[model samples]
Target chain A: MKVKIKSNAFLIAVSAVILGLLAGGLLMMSIGSNPFEGFYYLFRGGLMNMERIGNTISTAITLMLVGLSVAFAFKTGLFNIGAAGQMLVGGLCATLVAHYVFIPRPFYLVVIIFCAFLGGALWGVIPGILKAKFNVHEVVATIMMNWIAYWSIYYFVPAYLKGPSLETESKSIAIGQTLRSPWLTGIFGGGYINLGIFVAIAAVFVIKYVLDKTTLGFELKAVGSNRFCAEYAGIKVNRNVVISMMIAGGLAGLAGMAYYTGYSRNIQIGVMPSMGFDGIAVALLGASNPIGVLFSALFFGMLQSGKGFMNAMTEVPPEIADTIIATIIYFTATSVLFSRFWDSVGRRKRDKAQQKSDQDESKEEVSHE
Target chain B: MNNTTTKQSLFTSPLGIAIYIVVGLVLLAVMATNHLIGMILPYAIAYTIPLLMTALGGLYSERSGVTNLGLEGLMLVGYFASALTINLTEQTLQASALPLGLLAGVLAGALFSMLHAFASINLKADQVISGTAINMLASALTVYLARTIAGSGNVRIMLGIVRRDIPGLSKIPGIGTLFFTQSYWSTWVALIVWGASWFLLYKTSFGLRLRACGEHPSAVASAGVNVYGMRYFGVGMSGALAGLGGSIILITYSGEFNGTVAGLGFLSIAALIFGQWKPLGILGATFFFGTATTIANVSQVIPQLGVIPPVIFKVFPYVVTLLALIVFSKRSAAPKAVGEAF
Candidate 1:
């Protein structure tokens, strides 16, 4: 009732965020903690210093790319649940290039991009093919691909890229070999800030342009809305499905590059990368728009980066941030209730206007008589 | 035509294929090492029980027209509940603590699943997103709550259900060594549940109505059946069984609530698909995955399996599932109205 503006994706997202915050506050209260104190520390933690801001941005880079991947696939109505696997494969490729490629820095970026994209695309294409050619559900196929990639990385990291003493993670790359540049490091004052930020920003614009302007994007959307209609309209629906997944995989692959090569500088075994799923939330919050995904990823990145500081200062657990994000996604999924409410309000206004106009016409007729 | 159809069905059926794969793998293991089958049987069964229970829970939900991707999260709720209960009560209740903990797990899981039911069924939300929310919320909330109680976000119990042999059954030669020896009581409970589930699903009028709701909710609605009520029951059963599965894992094997079920819930959903939505199919699928996982874990210790890369065994279940999906794509046995909001 209080909402004056017409409900749109942005307002819906804002509403969900507010509800999520309240839910998180309720959780804090249930634990006998001050919600205000918890939130104060949470925001302060993410924006306390230049270094933390840099960390938040770097975190957002990975999340943004993964979000783009999910958002892109969602445009074509495919759920890419295998982003974690794609990220791992992409990270492995980047790690391999970082370790052994021994190329000049000028051309290294190109090589890394190609290798990472190829790796991720290979992983994505299997499920894409399954979905497009065989009618197998992408969710299940991607899930299988995710586990396969997980096990492969679990075996590969230890067997081939083990750190000097640690058998679980790959050896750290030199800063020069990684995505870090000296000037960016100096500006950030010791954070994981790197060229990945630029890449992420570029990806946001590119994905937006592709979705907004390209014929391919139109075809993909067409197939997504109604495959039979798209097919009848002379669009290759199957090709679009495969291509959409390919591009999505490539984006997630870049996320792996941003994370492993740019931020962490190493690959680990047995972890499925929670960013993969968080990206789904990011896509939903963004309403499957590339630009929207960027902002949502940044918001989530702030939550993830700030949680630790909040935990250190308050009695609240770091998991409260995740709890809040989960709650937001829940509210977003159930936003149909909000839509229904909006429709009711609109209907009441229309009815009132109709009655007022009818009363005016009757009064005018009486004056004329 | 009937004989030819039977032959073709035997060769192509998911059950037949799963059986062949298991038997073939067992034979290969036996040929390579004498003691391998006997040694791995107990571990395999232990692993299979959790997956079997979870997948069976999935069977109920999907058959009733709800695509439950939140099985993993529900399993975690049960895992946390059981661990918390057992840890809190082990000193006072002693032996009875285990049963209470399991009951707590089942109750918690069923209770948690109501949220998913409300969102997906009532609100007509996208089932996948709603299920994913359930997964994310349960995971984060459980860990957040667990930190308050356990101090480190993990709940561990000192008392686990110890493995024991059935006195009479253990003496039955080869079958004894494979099935009855060194088994946890939880295994028997899960098997009994599976048997009961099979009967409840196939032999009862209630089960037929539930299955009918999945196939055609409108048709069932015309027959004066409550589609929503049946779906709620289906989802509730899934939650209860998945919780029991989570509890069994804590009591028998894991002995801790570690804020995650390690994707076993997703694996069980894959098993449900692999099994073609039947009780027998699920048994085969879970058993197959369990054996593959056990082999992957123990391959390093076993001389015969050590020659092959552990990665092969680790990736086998997923790869096989993908292949099965491809093979069955033409005529899928999925519930028609599954994932649809009725």
Candidate 2:
């Protein structure tokens, strides 16, 4: 019964996704575009070419990092919408250190990544501190902080990177500091996908392990589940809130470096990436689980990758993918309702098992008595 | 004992005059810098009025405990609806189109916000998630609609509304250039909206009920006030203001709607927080932020600052916003039940 219900829940979610895609496809068709051709190209274009696959991988890596960031905050029952702002500062910090810090290529990469982590972490701390010390809401604090980070990087990057004349971005990284894949350089002729993707994957694993197996994770989960209960149990709720935000910030920061150092060299600080906010959708779709996030991130990466194909092969615009993605996210946000449906099925199964066992046990107890 | 305790308490209070000191320093810095003081200040004040109006809109929603994360998306819809309506009408009625367009924009904004109200208040969905979905929906819908109308992603008003030059105030000194020189209709709307909002929020029974709903919806509902209705009103009000802000950008600044309306929504959110959710506080916050942004945009005009890297000045608003939020986070008071749906 329980398994049946679980399958039913899964089916509902799957159907919702299919419905969203169909709606998007129909919308495209109504505008005189061939949906079939567009989808075929989306898959073909993104994965068909080695170079395109590399780009998709790079994008997936960044999205995963941001997704993880949002997931971490969600685990602690905090919504950190400031990931975009943190990423900007983190990317800026990493670039600054990479430009100024004179070191060997490999060593420079390590230091820059660290700088990104700290930069993002520091950005996160502002909201953490606010929520901890004051009764201020994390949502408002983080949202506001994102704008501040945007302006700060805008001013800092241009002023210091260039002496003062150019409106364009700062110069590229030093030859030693330009992020390059050693294996790709050795074999495939300068591929952009680096070991940073592995780093992101490893970070996901470590976070999953910590959340599932550690005391700190348990404490955080307890607080998230019920702050009143955790408070009664003598846990320091404020400390947990602060720490969760810091971790969330650090993950987003790393995502920035993974994108900049691994793929794009220049940092564009003026616009909010919308990537950070997209992380919220990914995290929701993934159910805030690490494994779920990986799959969800890949799905998003594929949609993004397929966009170019759809544009080239058919009349459908690449933005149709965005609408589909949003639809998926909307359905996933309501997953709680689906889960509740499964719970009822499980309850009936438990009741049947208890009745049978109790009847047999009661007969034996009567005989013994 | 009572006197000493009272004195100590006053010194330690979060709302102490120390906040005034920080605000003063920011103003002083703007004044002391030649380019910032002389050139950018006026543009900031002018530009800020629209955002201030939007923030007030958010204030109404948030004060009722529903976060309007869909603000950006809603604002976009508001802009396109208003712009398209105004543009279509301008051919028949040239000068009279402006007021008609704004009214149409407000109505459109209210309609757009109702969708959010339906999902969040009526369906009992998570507020933040519903808001996010609304934003995504808005972005796609606006792009598709605008593209259909204008052929490209861009939507230009061939004959947009003209600016009005204030009669006596137009002749004032250095300050007059920003406000009086080709003032858009949106600017007047902003001032009127701010005054009207202040009265609505602080001086009326409706405002009291809205605040009560935000703080404790269950109690408010128990007292016979319709909590859901108040929430719908709050969300609708924010949508209206944000919609006005979006149209103002098109009609006054760009005279068209494009994809460039990116950070303004977030900036307005920051402005609201920086303002400490107070009318007077918002005025100061919006003015400061507005000036910072205008400086970034027009610093190239100032030969002195033009010597520095332009991108730095351009992103200065985000930096200032970050710094201000960090500092303000330690001090500011938001609505009591901000993120909670009820």
A1-369: candidate 1 lDDT, tens digit per residue: 001122388878888999999999999999999999999999888888999999889999999999999888988888887899999999899999999988888799999988888888888888998898878889889988999999999998888888997888889998789999999989989888889999899999999988889898798888777778899999998999999999999899999999999999899887889998898889889988888899999999999999999999999999999999999989888888777766788789999999999989999999999
Q: How would you class the docking of model 1?
A: medium
Off by over 4 Å in 1: A1-7, A349-369, B1-26
Model 2: per-residue Cα lDDT at residue A359: 93
Instruction: Give the per-residue lDDT of model 1 (tens digit) for B123-212.
Output: 878888888899999999999999988887889999988888999999999898788888899999899999998998889999899999
Best by DockQ: 1
lDDT of 2 by residue, A139-230 (tens): 76787678667766667667677534456566676545756566754443444676667868998898999899998998887777777889
Locate the minimum summed-lDDT window of 10 residues in model 1 chain B.
B1-10
Show model 2 residue runs off by greater than 4 Å.
A1-16, A49-51, A96-109, A155-167, A173-179, A182-191, A336-369, B1-19, B25-42, B86-93, B166-182, B198-207, B295-335
State model 1's lDDT: 0.88
TM-score of 2: 0.83
Cα deviation at A139, candidate 2, in Å, is 3.3
